[model samples]
Target: MTGWLVRDAVAGGLAGAIVGGAPSTLHALLTGRDPLAASYAAGRMVLPSEQRPARLLAAAVLAHGALSLGWAVPIAAATPPRRAALFGAAAGLAVAALDLGVVGRRIPAIRALPQGAQVADHVAYGVVVALVCARRRVRRG
Candidate 1:
């Protein structure tokens, strides 16, 4: 049981990071904006006044990965096998509400991001996590 939980968490976390980050990154590039803008913003949470881009990017990746892993546990555990996608999408929206709407309001950097992109990313994260968890369950059976 513990092993399954750990595997689910790790798999879901990786999937969330990839699926969640892609849209924003692509949007930034398409809009002629810095693709790393979101990463920088995430990094700012830890290194609030850091001016160096490299350090900031690194911090952002680490932070994002950590947060993804943290969120994956609950998402993986709670997602129902049936209609997992729908549940994931709803969960993602809820996560966005808390992470972006509530908590983000407190963080200037997070607040400054494009709301649409961030929300979309959160939704993607949720769906991917759910799908990953569901897929794992099917394979195990």
Candidate 2:
């Protein structure tokens, strides 16, 4: 059980870092914005916006991975692999509501971006994490 948990966390984290962060970063870059800066602004809850150095991109990526892993643990434990994708999408919606409805309203930096983009990014996160965790579970079984 402990090993499975660890595997899930590590897998989810890596998936979130790559599958989740890459799209948003690329989108921000293509739109003529600094990826790290955008990430800092959006994720001010984890890392402050003031420290928006390019070097901090690694930290931001790691933070996303960590948060993804944390979110994955309970979801993995609670849901079966067969329903992972659906549950993951629901999780994404919940995250979107919390972020846009609550965090964005409270945080000026985060509110600067379009709500739609954030929702898409969050859904991407959920789907990637769900797929990764499900794969891990299936492989183990």
Candidate 3:
């Protein structure tokens, strides 16, 4: 039970990293700062996964992180918390919509990161897979 929670938190945080990376990157870009340099500093939410044996579990974590990333900080970066929350959810939904658009479609040989995406698409899949499996376990229990 504890392990599952730990996994979720870590997955949540990694998702947080993805969530936080964008606006932080945007901040850096507009200011002519190096986005990579700020990646960890601003994107410190991702922690190492505790559930290594479960592949699908990890991938869901990635997707959750991606979903979280698409929503979280950027909305709150400059606006009021309430407004940020609304915008964050909107951003999350937009990203989710995009994911829905391409989730099963093959990318041929390579899945390139979009112009401002911080992490690669494949890596995100791995994390998301883990998260998904974890969720299934939670449901079963």
**Highest TM-score, which number?**
1
How many clashes would you count in candidate 2?
A: 0
| Residue range with the least summed lDDT across 10 consecutive positions in model 3 | 104-113
Expressed as tens digits, the lDDT of each residue in 1-141 for candidate 2 is 588877786777567546765666677778887666546764565566546555455555566566667776765565467877787777767777876788677877667765666777777777777777888888878
TM-scores of all predicted structures: 0.94, 0.76, 0.29
Clashes of each: 0, 0, 27
Candidate 3: tens digits of C-alpha lDDT, residues 1-141: 356544544554465455445554565677786655432221222322322334434554554455453333332232222333344345444444454336422321112223234333323333343343345345646
Which lDDT tens digits does candidate 1 get at residues 1-141? 488988998999898988898778878888897888899999988888997999999999888999899999999889898998999999999999998988788888889878888898998999999999999988998
Tell me how far the alpha carbon of residue 47 in candidate 1 is from the true structure, in angstroms, after superposition: 0.7
Model 2 misplacement above 4 A: 46-52, 55-62
TM-score of 3: 0.29
Worst 10 residues of 2 by lDDT: 49-58
The residue-level lDDT of candidate 2 at 114 comes to 57
RMSD of 3: 15.6
Best by lDDT: 1
- Checking candidate 2 for backbone clashes, the offending pairs are none
The lDDT per prediction is 0.89, 0.68, 0.40
Model 1 stretches astray by more than 4 angstroms: none
From the highest TM-score down, the ranking of the candidates is 1, 2, 3
